[model samples]
Target chain A: MQIKHAASAGTLESSDITITLKPADNGVTIALDSSVEKQFGRQIKAQIEAALKALDITAVAVEATDKGALDCTIKARTIAAAYRAADVQDYDWEEINSWIN
Target chain B: MAELRRIWLTIDHDEAAAWAALLTKSGLAVDHQVEVTFGMFEGETLLATASLYGQIIKCVAVDPAAQSENLLAPLLQAAFDQLDDNGSQHAFIYTKPSTQAFFQSLGFKPLAHSDEVVLLERGYPDLDDYLHTLQQAKRPGSAAAIVMNANPFTRGHHYLVSQAAQQYDTVYVFVLSAERALFSAADRLAMVKLGTQEFSNVVVLPTRDYMVSSATFPSYFLKDRADLAVAKQQARIDAELFVQKIAPTLGITARFVSEEPLSPVTAVYNTELAAAFVGHIQLHVLPRKAVAGAPISATTVRQALQNADQSTLEKLLLPSIYRYIKEHSSHAN
Candidate 1:
């Protein structure tokens, strides 16, 4: 499956990226375009979010284009968008338990 | 060179005339005419001038002509010597940041910053209200004793605080907030806060003039206040009452101070104040903590920095504090 993400400022060229994901035996396979590759190195936020979603047995494709978002904020936004697209209703358990235990 | 004789005194005059002259000359706004006493000192031929208001002293001056000859050292020494002779309990001095080195050369330690003064107390005053306030805020049956100073908030200070925390359920660290310190009060408070962030139960507050001023006996700022012993004593009596009677309204009880043999005058005054307490507060003197070649003193830390001995300073301060000094020094240069 494929997902495309685009982000831009008011005037500057909108930095964009496309990602392709496939469910594997153990984890998920992620492929990134050159634009995203230059901005965030390979297997960065995109792969991390895909792996998190795959943990719930949801095989999904996700892509994001970030315009100067900090690493933490990017990770949060990507994870949120991924969960919403997958229609996962109970991902909060993982977040809450991470803080508790 | 001839030896200079130091003469210290607390002068009584109508507040309107004396302080008004001072304010007008110094270009400060004159507001109220409170009955205030000025603490002054004369060495050989009045080399330097200073004034004390409650627990704060301001306008410490050394004649520019005599600056090359370093007149403040002898003047300060004379002030302390006179206080000792008169049996006065303590003395305190406040100096501007630019002139701190001059006073420090004469063994005047840098205290925490207040609004516009840095305070140096010759002796520690009693913490009766501080103790009572602690008792009132602490959990039932939980008692607290805190000895607060600005040791520039180093590792050694952290060690002392952790030790104090072990003995009490809650510890109140009173930072001297006088304005005369070299580092701004905000910086001192930040250093202290960063240094002690690991301790959960320690509460930090400012020690206002009422608790740490030379106006209280034994006078800790000027020695000549001893010559006017009766008036100095009355001022201290009034200041102590102000602390004991008024400070409780602010919730402070029991004060903790590090034990220092070099300054026995402070020890004696602390004893007297504790004895005078009417069962509402207490004073605790923690034993001095020494770490091999260095004693955990702000004076020693300053000396280490002045000597540019980073190794010795590192042993005395936390890594963050050492970094802070290095960063500030680079920026200054």
Candidate 2:
């Protein structure tokens, strides 16, 4: 389902990422802000793009503020924001639990 | 003099990368508030570097080869000059454990520490200043204090302070000093002052760095990062600062807080504080005041404002706070 509204999840806390999203007219516009941008900038961008692709979000505006979060946390937060934007009351637990299991 | 010249690095400076590399190598990240940076140079090489961001002194590094008994004080003195010139009386510095005692000698008290670094501060966080200002104003009896953010100063806040006012001879309400919260510190403090004016014996003061200021904890943990290990260390540091410094300064017999049915972070914080302060001071975890069977909370008030639910906001907030914050929307910070 296409995301219809703006939503955000996670926080700017260290070892976490706060991902905010809004509907985009074209392809996904990804903007990243990270403390470790010098070292992990490319990797963080790639990870977020991958997370979006996995969630079947073809087009959206993504603003990610990362504070040294790992790949799993990045994916989890992105998925959460996407779910909220899609107006889903319940999350796909099987997909979420897969991150841990 | 030529061998030990001080160099200031700016983003456009030729050696900015070298300065950042030095900090990165030292297990430190570049501070966002990269104001004026000072580096000690020996001819063609950078020997030592320290960056001053506002009153915070961070991104410090001294080349291992340049280590000596007289390395730090001169560098710090230069930074202190800049701070003093800017009228900054208090400053905080982060340094490795090995260097804690060195800074302590210069009158910088250790605030908190983890396995990696310890935070030390000088001057401005002076509990003495707060005491002097409040000393004559202190009512003649046992006083209980509570530290609150009072984001928009909801009735939930009123209920807590009202309870404190009734129970103690005086209530010292220390509003959170950090302006990191959504409701600007100015707005929150103003609303709190207006809302609590009814309590004759209540005096509101900024918590400053005495309670849980950003300096008292790892900056990450203060940013809502839930690391229990870090939280425990930070809590111990805060509790000790309260017990040994602020409490003694204010003559506080008890500290009151609304019980958390909402935040897990607060739950851990209150629990840890209680455990550490068992014999020293009293911790009052008051039950949450409810309205129509639901807990009255600042979060609820903020939600009401966001949804444009005037009736919910009316029930959640007092008239004074309503007047100030009715049109002003805020979010959890």
Candidate 3:
């Protein structure tokens, strides 16, 4: 879905992530910041990209600040942020869970 | 390890003394006037704290013992959430150079820095976007700049802009965008644009949050009334941002100003700007334009405004500016 507005979800606390989304002109750009960037930066980015792909969100700028969150947490934060940026108030939990699992 | 309870000083002022002590211990001066102050406490001990003043987050201090707790991340999260609630799409932090990396981890990109302080920001339409917009307006020539609040555009402002227009191949007038003055930023900018229409070489632009903003020069706003030392440091930060980033980007070689015989705050800023611009950019201080024996100033214009003295206002302002003020003030009344 096309991102309608800028939104963010999650926090900077431990084992969590903060995802900020801004509407962009073209393509997805994810700027990830994590202490584990050297080790799992690619994996973390891959998880975010996969979630955005699941949501079919194109033309969005993503800033993810990771505090060593697990893949599930990362995906959850990304989906939450994308939905908010898209201004989709109601959640289709069945469909979202299908993408996560 | 018990879960930390949060303290909101705006809600509860009882912990203010503890908050000040913690900040002092962490090497931050306590500025009591911030809009929001948040503290994280484990039992009775204040572990970390952060405060927001407009769009700027400042006076953040985490106790060394709580360093293991990783309190900064959560503290800043609280700050950002508060900012979001305030409907501020952007935020800045004026911090020490040493702590830059930690804030960077939270997604703040450093925009400019001097030896003493670094200005970092987090949000869209950031400094690069601002600079890119400015780059479009850049002209190749001996360019000079003048930055002014122009609370009400006066003959004094016209004199400074006209003088620069004559001396330089191109002149850029950056009107202060801070809304703390008697006139709104939009009004101030309009007045400057209207007042300088005769100067063909002049380009009028808003300073945005990059220059003399509450972020850069908080003292310009009355509520942020700072002491001489604080004002000097803020002036240095503002000047360095210009000399290091803005001047080079826009090819501004020199800046023009009239001598300040009024307003001690502005006088201090002028002194600091002179010192900071040395060896980097040229600083020209022209004599104040006077009427009879007295200098023409926006402060004088404001005084005339307060008394509804049209004659004094007409004598001090250009026809365009006078007309704009007359129309707007009537609308306001």
Query: lDDT tens digits, residues B12-47, model 2?
Result: 466677777777777666654457777776666676
TM-score of each: 0.41, 0.61, 0.91
* Cα-based lDDT at residue B304, candidate 2: 77
Clashing pairs in 3: A1-A56
What is the per-residue lDDT of model 3 for residues A1-101, given as tens digits with 9 covering 90 to 100? 87887788888788998888888889999988998999999999999999999988878888888899999999999988888888888998999878688
Candidate that would win on TM-score: 3
lDDT per residue, candidate 3, B1-333, as tens digits?
524455666566668778988889988888876887777887876878888889899889888777867778777877878888877768899899999999998889888787888889987657776787799899888999999999998999999998999999999999998888889999999999899998888988889998989888888675335677788888888888898889999999899988987677788889988998999889999999999889998888999989888889889999888889888885444
Flag regions of model 1 displaced more than 4 Å: A1-101, B1-147, B214-218, B221-253, B329-333
Which stretches in model 2 have alpha-carbon errors above 4 Å?
A1-101, B1-38, B41-46, B81-87, B94-98, B107-119, B184-186, B217-222, B225-232, B261-268, B292-294, B326-333
**DockQ for each model:** 0.01, 0.01, 0.65
Error of 1 at B179 (Å): 1.7
Task: Please list the Cα RMSD from the true structure of every candidate, rounded to 1 decimal place.
Answer: 24.6, 22.2, 2.5
lDDT by candidate, in order shown: 0.48, 0.74, 0.86
How are the candidates ranked when ordered by lDDT, highest leading? Answer: 3, 2, 1
- What lDDT tens digits, residue by residue, belong to model 1 across residues A1-101? 22222111110112322222222335444432233456565546654554455445344433333333444444454445454444455667566346322
